[model samples]
Target: MVNKPQKTKLSSVISLSHSESTRIFEKKSDLEVWSAFDKGDEMAFNYIYRGFTPIMFSFGIQITNNVDLVKDCIQNIFIDLRRKRGALSEVISIKSYLLKILQRELFRSIKKESIHSIQNIELPESAFLIEVSHETKVIQLESETEINTQLKMALNQLTARQRQAIVLLYEEGMSYREIAEVLEFNEVKSARKLVYRAIESLKQILKN
Candidate 1:
């Protein structure tokens, strides 16, 4: 008689399929992942939410120091994305697009909670904080403390918009067009000019 073949369990097969799908989604490019999400792929949505939630939280906290507000805004944007995924347009950079949404949401929440009659909600220079990393300190070595102090002081002298522009350009590695979209600038040149002026100001401050 021929030997009988062993059959795989349905549960094991399903688990393996899910694991493989997750791995594939993780490796996909942003555009591909986004397109998958737009098509109502649950795995693609999970990949996007897991990948970007931390980044969105960090960016939101910089806009305003309120932790709860940032958390709520992040949650709300993800929910909105899920609800409107089919209607969403294709974006060149997913990071920049999500960030722009979070920034606007945070600002709107802040304005609603403010008691003062404010025409425009301009964030105080103190509101956007940039902390130096421990790795950067180790790299600087001998003059770390003094240099960190001076660098922070230099940053403090910049306007809120300038500081934000510098961070988006250097830390986030976004293009001028992306930065313009995030900051609501009319043109890409405006974003370019903002970064240029910010760098020049930093150099001048460091020189002194």
Candidate 2:
């Protein structure tokens, strides 16, 4: 198993990313960064990697069972981006674009292996990782254990795609268009519909 980074350090990294992610991701700023990145800007490249690497790891292990493979894929994605930056297409959301890369890379890795065994072995752990924050629940145990359980239970009731859509829509604050692009859907409206259906399913799961 590839070592998952400690939550404390990941939290600090994400905290730092909040401002940098915001600044570089503003509407005009995104174009500026991409323009600079395309022209072989090392600072721009480092900024993108530092800002995204942590969450990308968390997201990747869900898509593929092999943590090591996920780690390698992450590096490969960035390396390819750096090498081909000049020919890259303009994108609306860099986060979404990066997510698309992660998903595609994971899919490629999965296809080359014996997927059935890996999927069966890893699905439960990966699903839980995505659904419940271990650190969040620890402090909340005294006050809100039931709420936490309810969320995990509700998330468990979802299909994997539904769970992914819900997380992207609510937690990541991605718009439908961005989600459509990341998920490779033909239309943005489909992404919105999927999220709505996931929300309704969660409500039904919690009710019952």
How do the predictions measure up, each by TM-score? 0.82, 0.75
Best by TM-score: 1
Q: Write the per-residue lDDT of candidate 1 for residues 1-208, one digit (tens) a residue.
A: 1112211221232233455567877677778888988888767776677678788888888877789899878776766676686888987678888998898888788888889866687667775566655454212334567787878788778888898887787778788999999888889999999988988998899898
Candidate 2's C-alpha runs over 4 A off are 1-28, 115-143
In terms of TM-score, how similar is model 2 to the real structure? 0.75
- RMSD (Cα, Å) for all candidates, in order, is 10.1, 7.4
Q: Where does the lowest 10-residue lDDT sum fall in candidate 2? A: 119-128
Top candidate (lDDT): 1
Model 1 RMSD, rounded to 1 decimal: 10.1
